[model samples]
Target: VTSMHSLLQSATFLPQLGHNPLASGPLVLTKDGHIRGVSGDKAHIFYGIPYADPPVGAYRWKAPRALSPWPGVYDASFPRAACMQACAGPIIEECPQTVSEDCLHLNIFVPLEVNFSTPLLSSLPVLVWIHGGDFIAGSASKPLYDGRFISNFTRTVVVNLEYRLVVIILLSFSAVNKSSDM
Candidate 1:
């Protein structure tokens, strides 16, 4: 997996890390569909994690759609794909995305101190952040506004979500999805 910067939009970044992350033991990070990385007691931080369909082609500049649920625990060792927008620098294609009719996804920033086995605290709240690239440009997946800061600052969950907020095209998304069937 690779980590890179994203363009095309501005995202709200909320740090989720606590001050004493080093006090914990190592943690696991997942991505795609496998166990990816292990962090030292220093803390395991995953960022720009993708949780949906890529915003490419017909899905470009459109509303976000439902995401494909992952089977195994995702190894969020690295960041996921950022939205597609015009940029003027060395772009990293690591999180390559194709324009398609399916383009709804979310990213997460979770703390290492917490895990499934950990007790659930009703006081904990999750903050889901929506980006403002409008349509055609902008991605919550951008690297700069990622998990490191949040996982180190707060105990809450920070999610960078990508959704469709675009000017309606002449044809509806139904037609777009149909075309892909062929």
Candidate 2:
């Protein structure tokens, strides 16, 4: 579970990995933060990082906007909530505690460090994620759906995106596509 292999081995093809003597053993850190490092690269990991702003109150039934950035490191140990939808059906409930209209948010996972000083290639590759369904039925907060696994394995950033549900009007007998009145 704690292997240092890149998440996207298909892309980077890290020749330095695979039982190499230089790449062996977990990294040891310095108390002074100067990094008494080795010849190879650093191990990377990502946890739960909030991808969307909380969809509460006025955010109900509206497009998901931007999230307020944090000053220091933030904890992403939780899942995004299902939008103002029932576990099924429809009813006149303003907002539920577990599910709400303000439930548009996503999460990401990325390694903390990369070989940023490489002369030929100075940065890590970008990975974007579109979650669950094709914009029909899915929440970014589902269990095991987190990108942390990808981030840890690939040692790169992984983003999980969530879009709002389509607006449909139902009149018992038939279904109708409604405009963006919300």
Candidate 3:
């Protein structure tokens, strides 16, 4: 079985021949499901793809569960909410106003030249960027993290991912410790 990490790591060269002519964006079929991403001048941008189930309710304070294959084409043209966090200050406009537990999403930027003709083992390198936030704040949806220019200029696939932070991490550790005492 292909691990999710490897699947995403190699997603750069996936065939892009599944475009829906009636849709406004490009379509890419992943193991999880079909996703529609916007087409940019230099890259194809897929945003807010869920890598795992929402870390809410009973799932809270526990490890994230793998996402099952979704039934339909997921609209990945727009960014999703960032994981719950506080804005650093007034000038941090990139901080998303919406925050939720269901924020374990990732964004992918693929160069325009990488098409169906490209082999799955294409020579292009993949860059996986995990945001730095002192374990308290940060989001993959930040405009500064957009990978279009990097993907286009470097001729590579770029991926950015969002993860739980601060309170969530603390709660998780506390839960684990308490459970271990049982």
Candidate 2 lDDT by residue in tens digits, 1-182: 11111123212322222322343221222111111112312233222333355545555434445545444324333444555443344423322236544454444444434432322243445576666543345656564455556655676656554455543112211321243342
The most accurate candidate by lDDT is 3
lDDT of each: 0.44, 0.39, 0.79
- What TM-score fits each model? 0.48, 0.45, 0.85
Task: Indicate whether candidate 1 or candidate 3 has the larger lDDT.
Answer: 3
Best candidate per TM-score, number?
3
Better of 1 and 2 by TM-score: 1
**Cα deviation of 20, candidate 2, in Å:** 31
lDDT of 3 at 171: 73
| Selected candidate, larger TM-score, 2 vs 3 | 3
Candidate 1 lDDT over residue span 1-182, tens digit each: 02211210111221211222343322332333322333423334444345444546666535444344357655545545444444334543432354323434455555555543344454344566666543545566555456546754687655665544433343445566677554
**Model 1: how far is 13 from its true place, Å?**
21
Model 1 spans > 4 angstroms off: 1-73, 86-103, 165-182
Q: Name the 10 consecutive residues with the lowest summed lDDT in model 2.
A: 28-37
Which sequence of candidate numbers ranks them by TM-score, best first? 3, 1, 2
Which pairs, if any, clash in model 3? Answer: none
